[model samples]
Target: MLFLRSRVEYTKEQLFKIEQLRQLVQKSSELDVGTDDTFLTKFLHYTHWDSVKAYQAIHAYYDFKHKHPTWMAQHPIEYYRKLFYATHCRFVMPRTDKNGRVLVIFKTVDAFQQFPDYLQGLIEMDDLIFESLLMLPRVQQNGITVICDLQGTTRNFLRQFSPQFMKVVNDKNGVLPFTQRIVHIIQRGFLMHVTSSLFLPFMNKEFKERIFTHDGKHLSKLREMVGYESLPAEYGGPADNVLDTNLIFNHLSQSADYLEKLQHYKKRIV
Candidate 1:
């Protein structure tokens, strides 16, 4: 099993790979650009929206910029500016451990919110509105692990950052509205686990442990204070209804899968 520490390290390696790929993509001809799409398509076969592909895509674009500094300088200000905005848009952090593995961390809806005000002010001073918008705040896990947060509208943001990886469940084909609701419910369940189990635990351990270790008397008392008869299903508490049970199970399964994959990735890096 891989420790949380090593996972962070692996993420750095992945980031490096992404940067290299981006450079290669940038220099290649327009026809060659499709290669990245092909690569992404292959990557998408297994992964979902929050997969490695998104990380790789953003890095690839960064590499392109590095190789085409002069092109950016020569193009019309407005044209180049828009291109720059489109390509250099997402924010990603490199979370790594001693042995260099990626750590699982929060996926901020808007990474720019994580940036320091000073840095943001500098970007604004340069009149780099586009770049400024891309700045994101990130917290390193254990003060070493890197975390990535993407900015912009969620759909457009994901498309730019990880085009192939983000799942497109709803296309032109109309599905029942309830299906969308179900999907959201499932996604929410997974998010709750990430927030409560992964992020919240790091924030406060004693408080969390207290909830878990409490006897029925304390648990009941706490529940009353919180206004719930029992713990929510995402936290592994008993379900009050069939829908709750299904949602809880779905969340538990997703969390288990995510943790397992993270462990697997960490082992490879270690």
Candidate 2:
């Protein structure tokens, strides 16, 4: 499935262009309203795409303030009126087959939407998805697998495989603070998965502070499941540092395996 997350300022023409591109490459497609099982469930409790306008207003105010600090200081409401003009755009496109199994395609990583509400919602949704996908079991009987199609050159591959990835890279080297936050969420998810076998009390505490801090109530349940009190402070034994990287690589490997299995399953069914 082409799991997508973006700002919500896309014009009808731009949206159509993206849709046409998907149709050319993918056999089937669907839009994820941040409700897909892949990555959005964990983060966004509620979302309203219509709020894009409010976000644009807020951004415009900030832009005006940045450009004319003295004027903004004197006319705050006027500055806010200018901020309202800033629009943030985002959208999603997913592809699936007759059997209802998702076929991975492409995703756009651009913050095309200039509105804050829309951007915030997307951020929350992406983080949740990234975290949940990272934490899923390495292999599952009924789960979307993760994979890294690195066979093609970065440019051509991103264009054909996942244009969104390229947009992010070209826009800012994909190193913006927001991007880093998303990556960190993914990394934490990876560490959680690989180190599920390891048990320690302090480890849970650290997770609560670092990863689960955003959602305290949820972390409380996890802490209970692991029986926090029983874990020793130094229990992870020394392998915790590289846990995130290992998990990411493992997720990619498992995704590749899933693709192979999907092909085989399709053949058998046919």
C-alpha lDDT (0 to 100) for residue 227 of candidate 1: 27
Model 2 CA deviation exceeding 4 Å by range: 1-36, 39-246, 257-270
Cα lDDT tens digits for candidate 2, 1-270: 122223334467544444443333233122211222222211111111222332232233334334333321122122222222231111111322222222121122333235433333333333223332323322111223111111112232222323442333223211111111110111124333322212222233323333322121133333232233321122111233211223222333345433222221110111
Superposed Cα deviation of residue 35, candidate 1 (Å) = 21
Evaluate model 2: give its lDDT: 0.26
Worst 10 residues of 2 by lDDT: 175-184
Residue 224 CA displacement from its true place in model 2, Å: 25
